[model samples]
Target: MAVEGGMKCVKFLVFFFNFIFWVCGVALIAIGIYVQVALGKALVVSGGSSAGTPVAILVLGVIIFFISFFGCCGAWKESYCMVTTFAVLLSIIFLVEIAAAIAGYVFKDKVRSVLKEGLQEAMNKYEEDPTLTEALDELQRKFKCCGANNYTDWANIKQFQANDTVPRSCCRINTTTCNVHPSPETVYEEGCQESIEAWMKKNILIVAAVALGIAFFEILGIIFACCLMRGIRSGYEVM
Candidate 1:
């Protein structure tokens, strides 16, 4: 009677919130994706990244916000099917993202700094003796990696190290270069920093995939609850 009607009313509210939560989740992911695209090619990041960091933070934040949103909806809907789905999704995303944020906030920065230092050194060296092409040639034997002709190829340093034996000379960009890190007399201490940054980057993507899984389930559980109740006739009618 009164209790039955009250319970149905609660479920209706729960369903509404569940839909809203999923919508938010979708928005966050969309924004995050946009941020990633914009930041990927940023060249002159005065503060580090032209845009990626803030977007990443926003993405994680939105994901977390929606997780709670859907969880609440599931609980209100009074369906373990929904609650369990939401909980599992939340738990997995929480664990993985926390791990990634810790890793990214820690080790990845180190790689970026080192790579920048190395590139700075290379840039200086190039300016000093751009005409002294032979000096550039000698640079090949010094640092065993491939790079763009007159600039630092910080992006592809890993390929050089991918062997049982280290490269005997700079990886030939075409047929001209043997010297490496011909920037300045600083930065290029030993290895390129891109290696660490690239390695960590792959892991960060994994975190996002886990988060997406959670968001997907958030939508699923609510619809399940709706279906569960929809066919039940009226609770007052009884089975």
Candidate 2:
């Protein structure tokens, strides 16, 4: 009777944790989509060099979504094979995420240079590529800044040179009829590169925190799953 009661308790806990894990998988997918849609535009404008990050995130989210479904089913059914598979999948995910987190941290310093190069490339093509133009415009306007370095950087662009005007997105006010030659007081003197880099740094920290938290919980889930499996095996042995 005691053994049965203990097994029941283990089963319930395993099921509950697996359920939560499944929910997390769903959340990952949602977050991946959101990040891709939000940041993918800018990355795309950068000649697709940085596009892999978001795509990888989306792919990982999908894998987690499916693997977590297996985990939930395994826990609910108390199936040894399913539970074993879930354990392996979770372990793999944990390792992959840890590696990704490490790589992101290690390469954090290089992000600015890469972004600067990509943004410059996009800026040069801004007039030719409507999509790129819109993306750059949105970035500039939202960040309340201009050019990769400063408004003067726009002076070199052939299109801007021909028109003898910088993008209105550089203006502090409504851009349509804003100053063609902006003074320090009339427009943002700072460059978008600095603001964008700061914003990216803030987001990176946020992502790291969330990823670490998920990994910590994943460790617990793995323990619960293994314990439930052991309890099943022991119960069978006793029977």
Candidate 3:
């Protein structure tokens, strides 16, 4: 009877963990979509190689979402085969996530170069492409920054060269003179590259924390699924 009770407990744990997994899958999907949309905007402006990150996240989220549903079904039915399969799939996903985390850490250094190149391309094409122009202006206003490096960087752009003016987005205040005759006090002196890099670095910790938390829950779910699989295989009276 104790053995049966223990098996029942394990079964309950498996079901509970699967529920958490389902919620986590939903959260991941939402976060992935948000990141994809945000990156899409940046990619349109910069034309960088960052399209993969969000897509991978989105794919992983979908996979997890489906896997969690399978796990829940396995737990509810107390099916040894299904529970074992869920454990195996979860383990594989965990490993993939680990590899992704390592790759992200290793490639983090490339962010600066990508940002630099993209910002420069946008600035150079500012006059030729209306989309690029709007993107650059939005970037400047969002980051409270002026140009790729500084307000002086605008001097190199042909369109701005004629009027000797920066975009109105660079202004600290809404004034015509701020664009035509920008001074350190009237315009953002910081560069978009620096501002954006700083913002990313600051938010990276939050992202890491969330990832770690999710990983912990995934490990727990795998363990509970394995236990339930063993119980079901032993023909334990968990019901």
Candidate 4:
């Protein structure tokens, strides 16, 4: 009877821990979502030309929190499947963050190179014929994707405060070395606009899937916590 009583006490403690974890998971999810799309909240600082916040980081943070919650529940209930699912989800979030950072670095270098080439080609085109102004405009549009603002673009301090929604790709970098124009202008380079638009569209689906996965785990955790608590209570009897 003593041994049986000890097991019941242990079960209660485990279930309580799992309940705490569930609360933490819910809190993390709430914070992440708020940071991502806090429409009503005032943005303390603007990220200039960026989609602004590190949305992927926010998403990954939420996922990790929920995974922990699920793990706690799984521990309480002794559900191996729930535990395994949490592990897998956590792994995916980590791997994706690493991959995305690497990709962003590599792609920034590529954008700079393409922009340099386009600038050179445009100068040549303009010099060929003063009357070839039409060609100059077309080439400007062509190089929009490979705009020079690859790395520092998002960190732009000055905003293109405009009524029209100008895509970030068109923003020109006002570097100290620039002799052409002292005041920077948002010049849409050839391909930058289209590329960002395409990337954003693709990114949406990826983000949605991750959010759903987190939600799923949170629900599972709640269910598991309830079951384990019930089991713990039932396990104890005066007999």
Please tell me which predicted candidate would have the highest TM-score against the true structure.
Answer: 3
The residue-by-residue lDDT of candidate 2 on 129-226, one tens digit each, is 89888988887877788888888788799987766577877888775656477666666777878877777777776676767777877898899888
lDDT of each: 0.48, 0.76, 0.82, 0.45
> What is residue 234's positional error in candidate 3, in angstroms?
2.4
| TM value for model 3 | 0.90
lDDT by residue (tens digit), candidate 4, 7-66: 556445545544554555565466556545532111111112222344545555566556
Q: How many steric overlaps are in each model, in order?
A: 16, 0, 0, 13
lDDT of 1 by residue, 49-166 (tens): 4335647656665765666576665556555566566656655665676686578668756647645554444433443544322333343333332333322453334433333212
Candidate 4 least-lDDT 10 residues: 39-48
| Predicted structure 1, TM vs. truth | 0.35
**Model 2, total clashes:** 0
Candidates sorted by TM-score, best first: 3, 2, 1, 4
Per-model TM-score versus the true fold = 0.35, 0.87, 0.90, 0.32
**lDDT computed for candidate 1:** 0.48
Q: How close is candidate 4 to the true structure, as a TM-score?
A: 0.32
Candidate 4 ranges with C-alpha deviation above 4 Å: 1-52, 55-194, 236-239
Model 3, CA-based lDDT: 0.82
Model 3 ranges with Cα > 4 A deviation = 33-40
